[model samples]
Target chain A: MSVELVDVAGLDLEAEADRVSARIDDFFTSLLQPPGDSRDQLYAAMRHAAIGGGKRLRPLLTLAAARLFGIDEDQALRIAAAIEAIHVYSLIHDDLPSMDDDDLRRGKPTVHKAFSEATAVLAGDSLHALAFEILAHEATHRDPHVRSELVLELSRASGPNGMAGGQMMDLAAEGQPLDLDAVTRLQQLKTGALIEYAVEAPCIVTRLARDARTPYRGYARNIGLAFQITDDLIDFAGDEAAAGKRTGKDAGKGKATFVSLVGPDRARQQARVLVEQAIDHLSDHGEEADMLRAIARFAIERDR
Target chain B: MSVELVDVAGLDLEAEADRVSARIDDFFTSLLQPPGDSRDQLYAAMRHAAIGGGKRLRPLLTLAAARLFGIDEDQALRIAAAIEAIHVYSLIHDDLPSMDDDDLRRGKPTVHKAFSEATAVLAGDSLHALAFEILAHEATHRDPHVRSELVLELSRASGPNGMAGGQMMDLAAEGQPLDLDAVTRLQQLKTGALIEYAVEAPCIVTRLARDARTPYRGYARNIGLAFQITDDLIDFAGDEAAAGKRTGKDAGKGKATFVSLVGPDRARQQARVLVEQAIDHLSDHGEEADMLRAIARFAIERDR
Candidate 1:
């Protein structure tokens, strides 16, 4: 649980999370640190938004997947950091007063609450741009084709038809009767899209063949939905302080969520089934994917 | 001035704008076409924000620059469309209640005013993603290096150090006195960054040498500043109806601008000088860059 390196292939979840978090910290520290004169305020706010907090779940997924391909750690970490930035930016925007209106995230004041709303918006927008910038950099991959594919895939997963499109659906579904199919589709686009991107990114980096990617995509699809269901379950029954954000807000707003749609027991049962299915897709990689298998289990089991 | 084809070398400025606008409209028309089921509203909102209603100046600059290298028109048009999407996304975000708080743009309701706030946010976010998606596509550039270059340059221009950074500076500058240098830096990052990107993107596509791009960069810098100066001038003197969006908001908010830092006549003269300098950089290409030259002149001379 301390800052020591864990056996990455082992099931030391806490140590692995710390490892990912350390990578994120080091990356942002250099990215934002400087003589930073005029832009100090902005750099500070961006740092605050991106640098610390979270379980580093998305980056962990990227790392685990990268390990599956024996990808270089530095290159994988860079991509993981970009994915973390995009996730954090989305969180920042979603917490804005005009959006979810949340005041807390990771048990601290949300970006807009800590900074100004204008700063929050710009910070989020900048992070989104920065994510693509990181992926496009030569440092991310030797192959420009790989770099380009990463950008293309990341944008598709995060953009209008994917992450952004899912968000649009979520907003529209609020207080409306969204059936299971609609909810599943919404979750796939909103949370699922980025999760899929994180898991599939290593495939893109290693230039996995089309057929070789199906298992990873399938693994991602199952876990993506499982992750959201667990999130909803946490919101349904867990403490807000432990969750690091508000809970029950969904029910407060009459938002259609898996837990609400299927009840807490059924939701928990469904998430377990998904975790197994998700792990099943990793069978192709055998023991090389143990970390990924560990993560799929962690998805539904983690309390926070 | 209608949607008729204009002489690319001549000064039929309005006709050229219309031509670019038509290209933009056609591109989005196909992009957001039917069979759009549950996400119809999102697609519709995206179309309304992107298609039609502007001078299409950014896209025109891109097209003009592309033509300088004899780049393929279809390829150039695709890049132009992506640039326009980025521009529109910025506008949509800027018009948000937490940002500029404008209700009008291009003589129509702003995205947030026409749609919901959440919808506007997602639409803008989606468009941002779409911009990168378009650029990273094989259709944008055959070379993966070129595609990565486009993504890198565009992201840098639009991200923290560029457009978003400029916006952060701007929001912080509101109700505060900003000197000429500060204002220049702000404008450079804000409006100038994207303008420079538009002018230089074709250079990336054509794989021009870094040193060979200096003239284009210089030209873009001058015209970018001129564009801002004229915009400030328009805010100072032009009618709101002609300007499309509310003008003089800078003055109303006690925000520093070119016109405010210098007198109106001085700002106008400065813009004129910049336009001359901008056009001078294109002397290397002669009449081959006439469209670019015409656009430079139009930047400072147009009523809007």
Candidate 2:
């Protein structure tokens, strides 16, 4: 039986997720076709890393948010693809021997393992470069200012002050006793920033004034925290086989997650609270925003 | 007895170079000041990698190119800083254990050595993100189109089909024999793309018609090739003390290079020829283009 949130119970995200994944795959295929040159290996590695697998949660969030503003599907697709590209690049780098050293990603051998370490490094860097390239492409928006804003918004979300900063903190905090507030801050930066960007990017495309983004930002922020909390909950008590990659890694490494500071039950309870609060942020909108409300309720459903 | 290109004789680049370096240092310091947070380590790592080192060749190239178009100095400086940030980020990643695995860079411990490998990786990724962020920042250019173009050009220069692809070739070519054509193609991507962008980017800022960029593109391509030839020549015969990093790695690794294919004398001669051709591309410009001419001549002067 499929679990569903009460208010968003009728929302069928699977079909939408499949569509987003298919669109992203098509984008990658078009962008990364074989070069018939030595660099073809680089493209191959990029394809293996990005082409398939993983729930299209982040991109779906982007699309869902775009639906709120009735953004052009093609423009929304680029934004979604750019965000997913960044997420994929991060995964490639995170799996390198110098970092998390995971042998598997998306249930396949990581890029470094399948290709080589040097190739993996370059592949990750290339994809990181591709994110900005995609956003800056003229086709992303008719207005150059919108494209520029997308680049700026995305760069800040992924850069030193956001995801990277949070990652640094995560590395430093290992084996250290961190309080709930500290952990929350770390989570906010590590994963919340990108999720927030995914939700707010539609506003950029729609040319909605910056001040009007408050409710949307609030909705994204709450869901981002809720998503991370759910991820931590899964890592704490979830099964290894079901999770694909290793589960219980947090407890194994003695990392301080939401579940470590508070019991799993309290953590799950807090995630539900966050989801409810997230849905409340969209009260100003009607049926057009139902997908966003659905996304908030289903944020914790990211099993992958 | 300093070496100087004969055609561009008496051009004093030292004073200008110093100014550019100081400006870049100041920009980095302003952007990456101590955050009074755990991310201070990341900021410190970024500062270490970017501040007070190298010839600032990429940024200086950007400034020199901008001079041809009479772009604003502050705008030129942002363009310069953005290019330098990409260069610095590449260097940081190039020194990673999974990539070039170098212990030293610019006579200091590589970021991975001074900081953790994880920190170095994150710092590199952050700086890569920063390049686009800087370019997309409104202060970089008043026109959004210019800023967007800057992001596109810079990202394309560094992405999979450019520097990263070339790097992949270099990795694959190690221990295998290669000829002049293969090495040229590799170096063009590995080092040539960014240099080309450095010189061509000014045209993007000025909104020069795409066709109008042909001469500048030719100039950049010639100097870019010349620059790599000079680099291989230096790597063949230069000193570690003067270079501030390990030298002779190409020979040590049996990697094919211009020197390997053409011998040192021929490589130097070829580099000089390229410099002259690079200068020839600016036949349309007058005294205002003197600095660009000087930079082309000095493209082979990057000892560190």
Candidate 3:
């Protein structure tokens, strides 16, 4: 079969993904290029960090969660953009030489490696501040309560006890033996925290049913963990070219990872179980949950 | 005057300053070591950057502003702490090799130079975020609208079009012939913005008269400009030991500064005018404004 024909079965997924990606691009474009400004280099750094990359998975989760509650796509877009900004900021900082020291990201040069470290730092800082600014500026979030909650939730997720805390834990755990529980907690904080925020943020604003939120949170938590585990497994087994990053680099650096702790087979098994749990959480939602489950499964099984 | 009288007067100032300093110190210590499992190294870096030696001018402005409105000193402490965090984050990022590239700040090693650049960036990021976090957490602000407004004001002052925009302008103007107007605009955004925030935040939270905010903003604007011009003059003529920084560095770098553009004598004259204007704004408020006016004069006239 032709390549197009082989991919045609997942057309709905592809179309939704494309729509989300375009929204993200528009968001970044609007954010980085404010009208009538001539700080070209700073904007360039911001654009370089934000545009033209990533799976848009964080934003997709945000949009998906909003949809489950009947939120219009437009309402979701602003927040979707904001979460992506936070996620992009994290990745930019993570790739700094003082941190992960990676030169490449998403098949391209990392922001720090591409721009100067100073620009990278500023760009990351600007992106982070911009995320809050974006949420605050959203005309749709007229309720002060909604705006405040969004700011609080995003800040909690992105700040010390969330992404930064997880990163610190990961840094502290380098070359150390981390059991399954420890690994899970670290992943939950570092990656899952933002994911949880992404899924829960729309619900927080819309005041969705607690019953609906509970399952979405459960599904997000499992998928978030599964996403990291599968990522670890991919780093162990996937081709560097296909992955757009150096495979086995994790082991080379003596970084404590799931694959290092439990072997690839068990890591894969864990991811499978998490994906199953994630899907099970959605059984009550009918067809609306199909994209979420599919995305979770894809997160676990994707080669890269 | 007799030596005994001199000692008594100086001691009063010293004791009051010490009391204020202790408040600043306690603020840092509490934030750095929050109760329970909340402490993290990023928080430590933030505390380190913020708590280190400085004149505590911004926090003092906050305290003074609150006191002028008859607000309790204790009630003002959190706002004082939050503004200081914003100030410190600006300084930390400013001292980065990419920005000001200063090795020393307030007689101590700068954050990025003292710690890893990555840590410095993260520390600045965390502190900036923490400022809003603390503001939002201020339960004493019974009105949610007040809390939201406080957050918005601080965010705007700290983000682009305020301090960040000023830094960009400063960077771009290096080695260029920036006119006096351009220099004032830069200083207003860079320094005046936060000073304005410091003075206005308390009033905003207390729901003080809308007219009350105008004078404070005027006072802060003039004082902020005076502060920068005095700083420029100090850089031109002050000694390194007393100034706590490398003397004459601004002119040496060919950066377009107030002193460099208008000459040191003119800069000093302009600073005097600004201080007078700053004091004039507080004419409506009585003795409480005296200390604030005294501070503006001290800011301009200090040799260091």
* DockQ of every candidate: 0.75, 0.84, 0.39
Residue A190's C-alpha lDDT in candidate 1?
Answer: 87
Candidates sorted by TM-score, descending order?
Answer: 2, 1, 3
lDDT per residue as tens, model 2, A88-148: 9988988888788899987899999999988888999999999999999988998999999
Name the regions of candidate 3 deviating beyond 4 angstroms: A1-10, A34-38, A138-140, A208-213, A239-247, B1-17, B34-40, B72-75, B138-140, B208-212, B239-247
Better of 1 and 2 by lDDT: 2
Superposition error at A169 for model 1 (Å): 1.1
Which residue pairs collide in model 3, if any? none
Model 2 over residues B1-304: C-alpha lDDT tens digits? 1354444443557778888999999999998887898888999999999999998878888888888888898988988888888889889988987778999988999999999888998999999999899999999998999999999988999998788888888888878968999988888888889988988889998999999999999898898888788887777767543556554778778798888788889988998999888888998988777777777777776563
TM-score of model 3 relative to the true fold? 0.89
lDDT of 1 by residue, B1-304 (tens): 2223234434466677788889889998888763365567778788889888887878899988988999998999988888888888899999999999999998999988898787788778888999999999999888999999999999999998998888878888878869999999888999888989998999998899999999999999999999899888888876354546555768878899989889888999999999999988988885668788888878876776
Docking class of 3: acceptable
**What proportion of the real contacts between chains A and B does each prediction keep?**
0.84, 0.95, 0.25
TM-score for each model: 0.93, 0.94, 0.89
Pairs in steric clash, model 1: none
Candidate 2 stretches greater than 4 Å from native: A1-11, A239-247, A301-304, B1-11, B239-247, B300-304
| CAPRI classification of candidate 1 | medium
Evaluate model 1 with DockQ and give the value. 0.75
Candidate 3: true contacts recovered, fraction: 0.25
Candidate 3: Cα lDDT at A53: 86
Candidate 2 pairs with clashing backbones: none
